[model samples]
Target: MAELPLSGLLVLDFSQFLAGPSCALRLADLGADVVKVERPQGGDLCRQLYVADLALDGDSALFHTINRNKRSVAADLKDPADLEAVKRLVARADVMIHNFRPGVMERLGLGFDAVAALNPRLVYGAVSGYGDEGPWRDKPGQDLLVQSLSGFVWLSGNADQGPTPAGVSVTDILTGAHLAQGILAALVRRGVTGRGGRVDVSLMESALDMQFEQLTTFLNTDRAQPRRSAVAHANVHIAAPYGVYQTADGYLALAMTPVDRLAELLDCAALEPFRDRSTWFIERDAIKAVIADHLMTRPTADWLAVLEAAGVWAAEVMTWPRLVEHDAFKALDVTQLIESAGGGTLLTTRCPIRIDGRILTSPRGAPRLGADTAAMLEEPMLDGNARVGE
Candidate 1:
């Protein structure tokens, strides 16, 4: 097999929960030798952050899901000896990631400037709930709270419905993605200049970025808040026929389609009066109500077949079980098996990236807390000036 692009790179993951660790997880997936630096006791807080109360080995499934393909070292940064050892490790790492509030790392003596002084080529990535100088910087950076504060909650649900947050931690995940992108760019720059850089991202910024399209419209227009559609609301700024509607058997999602074309295709004359493009936005609720009634007359599959055959962007809204069973999902080959420290396997997703047309897969799962500490501390490189791959 071709060598992964990030082979021989060393990344130290000093963050917990989702944003920082998710960024580190991607680095590991791309073949970086990522090591998690955690507290001697408990390790990543996410080890106990259970979702559906699922677990594998001794850690929550959520922890195993994000933390696979990485090693762990336990150390108390408060202890002088452990802090010195971590500093040595920092000197050798090509990259390091952390999610701490502003000044926390500085208080811990591991801020970007200090670490860059130790390793000039290090790419330091930091994640915060908000930017360091912002008024909201010190607030807790939890995903749900960030989503609520970033104007994201108002974008979903029908007009009559109250503000609704996404079921997933989209802000955390998107912030991680942004951190990874910035880190990658910094690394590219480092390759040219042989100097490291700091990359910072915040959940609030990422949340706003996730709604760039709608936010851009709001900014460029009269600065009036865009109202959610009264019916089948999907996007705050989109017109009718752009949301999920209940069919006889299930839900069907429709994307942008010409109102006239949809009326002819579905054989519904109620949409005929609102066929003009201008009315699509003004009468979106009425047009969607008519479409909803017409769609309820047929099954989702029946409507999907017709809409699909005509090249209209439509699909049956599928549950997880149904989606996993579909041929299209299977064709993607997105799942993989990873083994925990206890030697048991858990099925999870592989890296979505394909380098050299090869899907990245690692059989290794997350390590036990401090599993590699002894080995790491005993390394001869720590006593010498050499780094990994040197």
Candidate 2:
């Protein structure tokens, strides 16, 4: 087997919660040595941030899912001895990440300037709710709040319904991805210049970036608000036949198919007159209503057979159970089971990226709180002026 891309890299993760830890997790997935720095008392608050009330090995399943393949070290920034140890680790690390509010790091004497002075080749990554100097900088960087603030909530559901945030913490995940991208770019630059740079990402900025297509349209089109169809519209900008409709047995989703072709295929006389492409957006609701009523007359499998035969873009809308059990899903082989140090096991999705046709898989689970503190502190270089991992 080939060695992983980031085998020798060292990452110091001082961030808690989703955004920062997720970035470090990706680094670890690529075989970076990631050490999660957490407060000594309870470690990362996310250890208890249960999703669906699920816990694994005394930590939240969500925490276990994200923090796999990483070690943990406990240190209180307020303690001079512990802070000194962390600074030494930072100096040896190739990458450092944190999601503290604007002045928190500076107050702890580990801001970018201080850390960069100690190690000029350290890539400092930071995540915030908003930009560091904005009016909303002091606000909590929670995913749901960022979604609401960035107008992401208005993008989903029908016209009459209230604002609906996404089912997941999309902003946090996107911000993590952006931070990772920036970190990688900085690493590439550092390879040439031997000087690391700061990479900053904000939840609001990431949330806005996620809607680039629709947001660009809205910005250039007279500032008009997105007009969602009264019926089952998938995207605010897309025309008819771009949503899920209820079939007799299940739901069927349709992508952008020509109205005349669909009318001929489904034998719907009402759809024949809307052959002109210009009316698709304007009469989207009306066209969707007709399509919905017609689709309900047949089972999802029957419509899928016809649509598949007609070369139309359509599929059955499957729930999680059906999706996981499908042959196509199983063929991907994207899930893995990880065992924690305490002997607890969890079945979770693996990293989506593949290198050289090999899926990245590791058996390591999240560390018990401060599990590596003694070993890390006892390293030979930590006691002298030399860097911790040097």
Candidate 3:
């Protein structure tokens, strides 16, 4: 087997919930030994932060999904002894990550400055809701709040509809990805400079970054707000034919196809007047209305076949069941069944990245709280001179 990129590295995950733990999970996938440090009382709050009241082995299924392949050590920062032990672990860690609001880590004496002092070569990563400063810094960095505050909610849904946040925790997931990217970059720099650096990411920043293309256009175009289409629009900035239209049986998503070509294929005479490509955006709703009514006359498969045969980009919009059951999804091999320490199995998606043409996978699931405390505490310090936990 090829060696994983992050082999031999140790990551101390001092984060709770999604953003921080997800980052640590990726590092663990790449072969880093990730140790999740949690509060002694209940460990990470996510253990009980149930998503739809579903859990495995007494921990939320969501927690297991994000925290797979990690060991846990219960520690109370308020307790001087436990704090000292965590500091020692930090001193030995190659990477340390946290998503606490500003001032919390500093209050616990585990801020970047203090941790960096203990381990000069440590790559310290921090994720905040807004940023370390500004009026929103102290506010809770939850996903939905960040999405609403960052104008992300306005980007989805129809023009007449109320603001719609994404179905998933997009801000948290994107923030985690950004945090992982920054940590990787810092690690590369450390290899060259022999010095570690601090990586800072925020949910607001990540949410904005996800809208770079649309935001760029919005920013440069006289500060115009996104105008979602009246029809089944997928993106606010995209022109007509860039949406899902309901067919006789299901839905068919159309991409950037020529309106004339669609008119020829679908036999919709109304779309013929939309020959001018520039008018596609200006008269999107009218063109989409014609397309929508025409598509509803036929089933999704018939539309897809005709559109695909004509060299037009289109596909049948699929639900989770259809997607998972399809041969295409099976060929991708993106799903994995991970087993917890208690032997409970979880069906979850695996990492999308491939290293040396191999999909990354690990059988281990999320650890039980404090499961590795004694073992990790017995390991020698970074200098290999003594056991710091003693």
lDDT of every model, 2 decimals: 0.89, 0.89, 0.88
lDDT of 1: 0.89
Q: What value does the lDDT take at residue 379 in candidate 1?
A: 65
lDDT of 2 by residue, 223-261 (tens): 998988888868999998788899999999999998878
User: Candidate 1: worst 10 consecutive residues by lDDT?
Assistant: 381-390
| Residue-by-residue lDDT tens digits, candidate 3, 148-247 | 9989999889888999999999999989999999999999999999899999999999999998998899888989788999998789888898998999
Q: What is the TM-score of each predicted model, taking all chains together?
A: 0.96, 0.96, 0.96
Write candidate 1's Cα lDDT for 71-123 as tens digits.
88999999989999999989989999999789989999999989989999999
The residue-level lDDT of candidate 3 at 387 comes to 11
After aligning candidate 3 to the native by TM-score, how far in Å is the CA of 39 from where it should be?
A: 0.5
Report the C-alpha displacement of residue 47, candidate 3, in angstroms: 0.7
